[model samples]
Target chain A: MTRALLIGNSHVGPYLNALKHAEGEVALDLDCIAAFGDGLERYTIEDGVFCGNILDPKVTGRKGKGPFPGSEVRAVLKDYDVVLLTGLRFSIFQVIRVFRDLGLVTMDSSRDYATAAENGVTLVSEALLHRLIAERLSGSLMMQIARDIRAATDAPILVLAQPRPTRQVLVEGTRFETFCNAEERGEGDFVSKTYERLAQELCAGIAAHYVPQPPGTIDGGMFTDTSYMMGTLRPPFWKKNGRPVDFRHGNARYGARMLKHVARELETL
Target chain B: MKNPYSDLPPKAFWKTGVVQTDKVHWPELFVPKFTISANSAVATAGSCFAQRIRQALADEEMPILDVEPAPAAVEGDLAREFGYGLHSARYGNIYTPRQLLELLQDMQKDAVHKALIWERDGRYVDMLRPNVEPDGCASVKEVLELRKQHLARLRELFETVDVFVFTLGLTEAWIHAPTGRCLPVAPGVIAGEYDPKLYRFHNFTHSELLKDLKAIRVLLRDIRKGVKIILTTSPVPITATASGDHALNASTYTKSTLRSVAGEMAMKFKDVDYFPGYEIVTTWARENPAYEANQRSIRPEVVAHVMAVFLDAYGLRKTGAADQAEPAKIHDDAEYLEGHDDDLVCEEILIEALQK
Candidate 1:
């Protein structure tokens, strides 16, 4: 059995929740520790052990009943064979904002994109766009955590992207209008693939592997399917009823699907 | 009889003015015909030296009108690499007066030079400013589309600029044989095949330079009445000349002709003035020359001194550096000149490589 430890922000909920009910001789045994917002920023790793707020009950909102509950025991890096770090702040929505801000158009020949110049936009070269994306990812929290983990242990580290926003993001009145427009123009796949490549390259800078979201779980070109977005796992102490639609997180099914993909990727590695 | 020479100031004689004077403190090198205050809506274009001028003015908190600006997201060297923040508009290094004249004319017209698009390895480049898009456009259609937008912005730039600074760069240029339109660089150097039958080299004569400058002035006034013009000859010499003359002789001829024409224009027009940038780098600094070891790129300190004199003469020098917007950190000369990342982005420099 492969011992995997996942540590990150609130995005860790689904993955840890899926691991709770996981049964019948699974090849992967998973453990998780999570903190929301800047809660993780307070923690530091030293001598192969994470220090500060190992499991702050007040900060994580887990109280005690969640799969990964509050504990005074600090997590050690060398305890696991493989380490997974999610919530490194990779978001396709933010990538879309960059494209819109720069008025950048890709030269993906397979899809017929409208000439950017007609709309007073500039067509950036692929090499240049790659540099811009890499620059954007360089200072990400994921990169820093990966470096920290690499310094502490020789264990293989995998950086998982935050689940892509739901396909419903393309609907009218949403803030992702430019993203929706790009989809209408058939540029979605190219942008997503380009982001994936740059994100992977970012991981490689620290000798870590970037595990992308499972292709099966994604709908449209760069968004998680609605089926996976609903019924998302949240902290147990959270509001029991009438929470707004969670468009950015995935349900336990997605976590199970993604977990399987991660296992398969690890076997090859 | 007391001759004109006897009564003249120390600057009139070379011995007192140049050889004996300290290089750091040359007296009254440039007396502006008109003052350019910090509020002046300045626009800059021309050769590589003009970029230095743009940077200096931007540093002093001058209102440099940039119509086609790099979006805030694109910062520093990358912004400049894509031809932003290099000039008032993205027309990179207008090496010849004819090219500048043609660009101004194009700004007024609602047209695209479709024939100017050249293809290499399935990618297209706008031959006019080939280096602006380092990777060529995806198609011939994309090139034309971009050029159309660029020209529109140029029109806006011309209409709004209060002061326009142009630096004369070169006398030699390649022209389309049929249309007589000048290209910024040789065809094959950046992109496209060099068809001798289609393009030919032409060196602008003294008379031709004067004529082109005349037409440019007329057009500027026609576009925006009473707009002031500042003309300076680039101190940096041509990297290579297509004329059969030796490189040194060719460079001298190019600089001299441009200097003469600029002087003539300033003499004729009250609104036009000549800044002795060429003289500052070449003549005054006889012992400690302004040029780097390459003899092409000017030293950063020299550039700063030139701008100091310019801004000081016009009473436009900023009083306090504290209030100024954090200017883009200017790179030193060595890195800018040594690598392919020429901050000046001189297309003419590419010619030296082709000569080998």
Candidate 2:
């Protein structure tokens, strides 16, 4: 039986489910190793088996830890043929700081400016924090884990690039008022520019295959898409002028599309 | 009043003049001629009601242009604080046709202008003085000179726009002090400080709305003379108004006036159509009598139904097929999950924190 191991951020969960459904429909005998959690932790693989925590206790702590432990990751990877990675959350604060320092973002809101010290710290830390983590826990760390697992059984390592879902374009005439309101509040410039930059960066990274998932798509199941769903899940308890107004995120339709894309990728793997 | 359904024949039995049968055949209230199919490049912009239009069209599988620069921040507060997508106030109103035209004008005049200003920093940054891109017209005169050129492009876009839908959001707006520019909301609402002397509320008279419609039509005709325009009045009420009128009364007056304007325009123009999006949503589809939440937005399901009717009438194709199959099972997953699940808690905290 061909075994596949999937790991990454929240995006991996939906993709794994999609792959499973597709395999069932196609009648393929494929055992899959699916591990999805925060990317800040280390996953371990041992003696032809995937085991160990998918998240490091030191990094995430118990409250923020993954559903499983590091031993499970090691055991799962040992028996899996491939590992896939994707993230739903992006550190937009960091991207905004980059642009702000570069003079791309000009306007600062009272709140943004008031918290500038705190935000600055977050921005600085995020920029520097990921690289060190990558050195100790990612890149070579994953490679090392794979090598160790391979010592017991030889399996090809296929790291698929994350899929970048299509961005939500503001419908003309509708979003302008809200956008302008944000601007007046002082945080407008920083918030708008930073978020946009973050999307572009995410899309660019996914397009470039710098992040892992599948070619030609970004993970839409991430926190970004789900947040929309949460916001609009229920219509606002009150409305004005008889028109129902609510913000939206990823509906089931978008989720389905992302799932199908993952299913197609699973076929290739 | 002549029956609007006069053109529609009964689906079941045809009667000569007035034959009656037990089988009642009500003509489909709306029949969509097309669906938003996959691979279509769709763009939506207009007024606040346009948001509903976009959502509905998106649900039907139509591709909406992601004008929001950043659409991938996992944290709600960060997304809001950063200004990703259409939800930010910095983009400053997506509903105004004039503003949309102005933005396009800027982009056309300067090739890099939009990318530099709107698409940079992952969001649209507020520009007190918008700079023209190098490839665009150098002066305001040059920009005006290219009005015809821009109009042509807009017309072309309209022709290919399988569904050219818009919502007449308001009959009231604030005009800029110095430039005499019309803004959808008051300066203090979005950007610029509120200076009573600089901003004055102007409730558009029938004549002004008619004039604007004519101008818009003329501009559109320059692009695609045969393009169809679908207009609707926003049913969402006003939260607060500087007009001295009570909020409820103001909302009613604005919506009624806009609805009448849309109806008149539809009658005057053959290619123009008016959809009872307001009536269908507020009355026919409303499950709640109040019609809004405390914040004054419409219910999601009501909006969904309004859009479904729109698609039914327009016959537009849907864009994303892989996305829509099995709505039931998907909704089931959400139902099965507890209210305060991990995802929910995180999102709730994020959105609440960000609002601050």
Candidate 3:
């Protein structure tokens, strides 16, 4: 059996919920350690332990709910066959927004960008944009965590994909307007493919591998299908008094789909 | 019975004017015909040393105009590497008066020819301003499109500048054989192959440069009425010369011609003024040796001293920042060299490799 340790922010919720009802062959045993929002990024590996105040919540609050509670996470990293790192605030929406604001048009893009030139916007080449995005990601907390883990153990690292936001965001239009504009302008596929390609390259820099989001769960080129987003986890910060669902994460069924993909990836490795 | 020389001030004599002048009182070195205040809409473009002037002005919170600014995500060293915030726009290192004149003409026409795109290692670069994108563009179409947007921003820049500061760097340049348009760097130095059949090495004469300056003035006033011009000759020498002369003789000839042309233009036009940055760095000082060991780059302390004199003459020094007027104190050679490394982004230095 493969023993895997998963570390991330609230995106770990779906994986935990899926493992509860997982049955049959039991080819993999998974353990999870997570925090709310960017809190997980605060931990530093010290004296063979991932130490931070945020990790204390998972140790004390929900003891018997999950396999291998957060408290033992730091000491057991080397014992696992593989470590999966996911969701330190990286999002496809952020990438789309920066590219749109910079007045970027890919080589394959058919969007009319003549207006961008009239607004005194500078056009960046795809090669330059790729480098800028990589540098931008290099400074993120997820990469920092990856480097910290690599220093601590020799276990193979697998970087998991964050769930794409739901398609409802385009209709709501309260946030991530750039994503909507990109869809209207037909730049959605180029951005999605570019993000996946660069993300794979970044993982390769540390001799790790990247596991992309399950293709079955994605609707348009840039969004999650609505069927996977029902009752997705919402932290207190995102939960309004009467809101019915979290528009950003995926549910247990989506996690089961992602798990199948991850298992097949591990088999090849 | 007093002679004409009897009433002359101490500044009239070389011994008192240069030998005895201290840093604090050195602001009198060059009297300004016009002053730049906090409100002046300043635009800068020139050789690498001109970046020092922009840095000093920006450090003091002066109102310098940047027509093409980097996005908020690019900051610190990354912005400099990408060639943003280097000048009013990213027209990198306008080394010759002819180059500057050509840039202004291109802005007027609002076009950059597709021929300016050159490929290096399967990646295309703007032959006009190659260093702005360190990693070359993916395609020729991309280069032309970016240049189109750059020309539009430059048009906006020309219509709005109040004071234009330009430093004269070199008289030697490589030119396209068919068209006289000067290439910023030698072919193959940054990108493209150097073909003698298609290109020629030209060392501009004093007459040609002076004529270009005249045309530059007319263009500036035509775009914006009463735009003031401050011209300075860069003290930094050319990294390499395509001229047959020895490098030392080539450097001297280039500086002498530039200095003479700048001085003559200042005298001929009312709106044009010359600042003696070349005289300041090349002239001997008792305690401060200006150039670093490389004998090309000027020390940071000297650059600071030169700017102090410039800002004081224009009454643009930050209030209560009197310490900026004093010479930078250096306690040891190691300490001095520690922080004084040349960080100017110069593409001309690439020619040094060809000689090796």
Q: Pick the candidate with the highest TM-score.
A: 3
The residue pairs found clashing in candidate 3 are: none
**lDDT of model 3 at position B285:** 59
Candidate 2 CA-lDDT value: 0.43
In what order do the candidates fall by lDDT, top score first?
3, 1, 2
User: Once model 2 is optimally superposed onto the true structure by TM-score, how far is the C-alpha of residue B258 displaced, in angstroms?
Assistant: 0.8
Task: For candidate 2, write residues A1-269 as lDDT tens digits.
Answer: 34555444443444444444455543223343333334334544444455534554467565444542221334444445544333423323223323332111133421222233333311111222222222222333333444344455544443333322222212335433433333234444354334444443433332311223222222222113322232223333223245332332233333345544444655664
lDDT of 1 by residue, A106-181 (tens): 4432112245544434555554566677777776666777788898899999887778877666657777776776
Query: Residues B137-185, candidate 3, lDDT per residue (tens digit)?
Result: 8777777777777887887888999999999999999887767679889
Give Cα distance to truth, residue B47, candidate 3, Å. Answer: 0.5
In model 2, state the lDDT of residue B314.
Answer: 51
The candidates, ranked best first by TM-score, are 3, 1, 2
Estimate TM-scores for all models: 0.82, 0.44, 0.92
Which candidate ranks first by DockQ, i.e. highest? 3
Off by over 4 Å in 2: A1-269, B1-27, B31-42, B65-92, B95-162, B284-290, B293-295, B315-356
Backbone clash pairs in model 2 (N, Cα, C under 3 Å; residues 3+ apart or in different chains), count: 122
User: Which tens-of-lDDT digit does each residue in B68-158 have in candidate 2?
Assistant: 3332222343342332233211232343445544444443443323211212322222322221111222233222322322233343455
Per-candidate local distance difference test: 0.77, 0.43, 0.78
Q: Which 10-residue window in model 3 chain A sums to the lowest lDDT?
A: A63-72
